[model samples]
Target: MLKGIPKIISPELMKVLLEMGHGDEIVLADGNFPAASCASRLIRCDGHGIIELLDAILKFFPLDTYSENPVSLMQVVEGDPATPTIWKDYRSAIKKYDQDFTSFEMVERFAFYERSKKAFAIVATGESALYANILLKKGVVVE
Candidate 1:
C-alpha cells in the first residue's frame, strides 16, 4: 500500500530492508532454503521470483561499496564456471539498472549457508530455479 514501492515487497520486508544498517547482510533465497531455521527474521514473497524481488530492493537500497562481497552467489558444483541461467538474468538486471556492480563472487555451498546464518534477515522468494540464492549487503546513503 506504500507509494513508490514494489508491490511484491510486503510491509515486513520493507521494514527490515529499511531498518538494516551498514554491514548487515540480507539473503534473497530460493524456495529450497530452510527459512525459518536460518532467518533471524523471515519475509516471504511467495508469488514473486528472486529477480522481481531484487529489482524492487535495488530500487531503494544501494549495494555496499565497503565490502568485497557486496554480492555473493552459490557456486556451481566442482569447477562448473558456467553461470546458471538465473544468474544470467540477475546480471542483465544489474546492467539494466546501470549499477556499478558487474560481478558476483562464488562461494562454496556450505560457506553460503554460514554467511546466511549471519544475515540480519532472509527474504525467501518462490523462485524454483537452481542456484537462485543471492546475498546483499546494505550500504549507507551518503548525503
Candidate 2:
C-alpha cells in the first residue's frame, strides 16, 4: 500500500487519476447514476459516500485553477420536489480544499450524463443523496 494515499482510493482509481492531465475531468457519481453506461473509465467505489470520496480525492487531486468553474453538479429538474440539501455539504467540503472555489456549475441532468461520457473517469459511489454527483476538473500540480 502507498504510504500517503487514502485507502479508499483503489488501485484502478489511482491509475485513472494519474493518467488524467490538466483540464481533464472526473466524476463522483451518485448511486442512481448510470455509471456503467456513461463512463469512459469506470471505477467502482461501492459502499462509499461522495463526501468522503471528495475529501480523499481533493487531498491528492488539484482543482483546475484556470477554469471559471472547476466543479460541476447535476442540476435538479424543475418541480422535482427533491431538495438536495447535500449541496450545502458539497460546498463546505469544496471550500475546505479550494479556497477559490465559489460555486458549482449546474448542468442539466441530460447534459451531465453526456459530460460524464467524456470524463477521464467516473467513480461510482453508494451515496443516496439527491443530486450528490459532482464533477471535478484536474489542474497542474504546482507543489
Candidate 3:
C-alpha cells in the first residue's frame, strides 16, 4: 500500500486517473447508472459511496480550469420529485480543493449517458442516491 493514496482508490482507478490527459473526463457512476453500457473503461468500486470517492479523487485529481463547468451531473427528470441533496455534499467536497468552485453543469439524463460513453473511464460506485452520477474533467498539474 502507498503512503498517501486513499484507501478508497483502487489500483485500477489510480492507473486510469494517471492515464487520463487534460480535458478528458471520468465518471463516478451511481449504483443506478448504466455504467457497463456507457463506459469505455470501467472500474468497480462496489460498496463505496460517491461522496467519499469524490473527496478522495479530488485530493489528487485536478479539475479542468479551462472548462467553465469541469464538473457535470445528471439532471433530474422533468416529473421526478427526487431532489439530489448529495449535490450539496459534492459542492462541499469540491470547495475543499477549489475555493472558487461554484457549481456543476446539469446534463439531461440521455445526454449524460452519451457523455459518459466518451469519458476516459467510469468508476461505478454503490451510492444509492438518485441522479448521483458525476463527470469530472481532468486538468493539467501546474508546477
Report lDDT per candidate: 0.84, 0.93, 0.95
* lDDT per residue (tens digit) for residues 58-122 in model 2: 88899999999999999999889999998998899888988888989999999999999999999
Q: Whose lDDT is higher: candidate 1's or candidate 2's?
A: 2
Cα deviation at 31, candidate 3, in Å, is 0.4
Q: Show the colliding residue pairs in model 1.
A: none
Report the number of clashing residue pairs per model. 0, 0, 0
TM value for model 3: 0.98
lDDT of 1 at 128: 90
Tens-digit lDDT track for model 3 on 54-138? 9999999999999999999999999999999999999999999988787899999999999999999999999999999999999
Segments of candidate 3 deviating more than 4 angstroms: none
TM-score list, all predictions: 0.91, 0.97, 0.98
Off by over 4 Å in 2: none
Q: For model 1, how big is the CA root-mean-square deviation?
A: 1.9
The candidate that wins on TM-score is 3
